[model samples]
Target chain A: MRWLRLGALLLVVGFLLGTAVWLRPFGSPTAFEMDDYFLKNAQVEAGANNVVTSVVFDYRGFDTLGEATVLLCAVVGVAFILRRVKP
Target chain B: MSVVVRTIARLLLPWVLAFGGYVIMHGHLTPGGGFQGGAVVASAVALVVIAFGAEGLKGQKNLFSFLEDLGAIAFVALAFLGIGSTFFRNVLAGGGGLFGTPVPFGPNPGWLNTGGTLPLMNWAVGLKVLAGLGSVVLLLALFGGKEDG
Candidate 1:
């Protein structure tokens, strides 16, 4: 069992290290046409200086809505589990 | 913990809260946004919990829940505002109304009055996140009937 665990850890570490070494250089994306379009037009179209904020709240608002819903559910779940009962 | 810790937490609380508000308010113009700012504010809650213990925050869970609900409702309502054109259209981007200032192209100082619904959404999300995470910490601290120094 100890040897199996050691081998598994080594395999995972080797895979992660190999993947990191083979990764692309920083600041150079594999695909950036969409990013280019956003950079060029986000300010004018969304009227926001921050492109990332524009993207999160304007261009991709549905995703934010979904994220908000998920947070709501989580809070509700926690409240339910921790509610105090009347004797 | 100690009196020193409590005093420091009290002194730093307002500054942390102000920074969080700044991050959320300037989300459309700055690197930080609603989520990041909310997390920062939530840290203040944790600090309070750690310094003063869960007993200090008794009976505040409902208030957090209410604020979270309010934030969620405000967010969805803002999204519904642009439903005339589309679900999430930038309807007020250049409308010259509330939060409707148009942004200039190229690099320049960012305006706070611009971004239309973006800033509103940032506030809504910030409120929600702060309330939710703060309440979570409070609840966890209050759980199991345990007390801390």
Candidate 2:
């Protein structure tokens, strides 16, 4: 019974994924453009050439900081949960 | 099943690791980023743990922690330089060098040595993800492996 339910869920998810892949949203732009405009500008300001690097460390640095914090919390959580702390 | 699987994973692990490193180093000039490359590296380690058992990866505990800490420190130190100028500013390499001599490298963009704090942040992320993911896999494998007695 559980296996059947799992199979059903997988089938549903696969259908949804396939539908989304083939379906286009209403009036979406056909052409793609660079989303790293801020990074491009930051290159001159930060005196860095790599746009992605500039974005990560200079332009969108707060995001990077948050990402680091997330990693720290995850590591701490893993250590706490796995620690050989006795009752 | 066990022997065949172990043989295949063992054969593939080194190649996976090398490709991960290549992706990481060339991230500045390529499409893949630190997280992608780091996960690949960690996945390679995970394969080894799966094949050889948790004991095989136990020797790497200290190395993992060290890399994580060093990456964090390098990232923060780079940011602190920007504190006086602007948050996350590339303030270093303005001028001055050892014994009043001109520095070998100074504020330039696009080169490997350039990018200010970006490369440092990338290295930090690479270390953190690689270590964190490997550790997670190790713990799961250790606790999950058991045979009915």
Q: For each model, chain A TM-score?
A: 0.90, 0.61
**In candidate 1, which residue ranges exceed 4 Å CA deviation?**
A85-87, B144-149
Clashing pairs in 1: none
Q: Write the per-residue lDDT of candidate 1 for residues A3-65, one digit (tens) a residue.
A: 999999999999999998889976678999999999999998999999999999999999999
Q: Every model's DockQ, to 2 decimals?
A: 0.62, 0.28
Model 1 complex DockQ against the native: 0.62
- The numbered model that scores best in lDDT is 1
Best by TM-score: 1
lDDT of 2 by residue, B73-147 (tens): 877777787788677776643232311112232334334544444555667778777887777777666644453
Q: Report residue B144 deviation for candidate 2 (angstroms).
A: 4.5
Once fitted onto the true fold, the runs of candidate 2 whose alpha carbons sit more than 4 angstroms away are A1-43, A46-50, A85-87, B92-113, B144-149
Clashes of each: 0, 1
Clashing residue pairs in candidate 2 are A49-B110
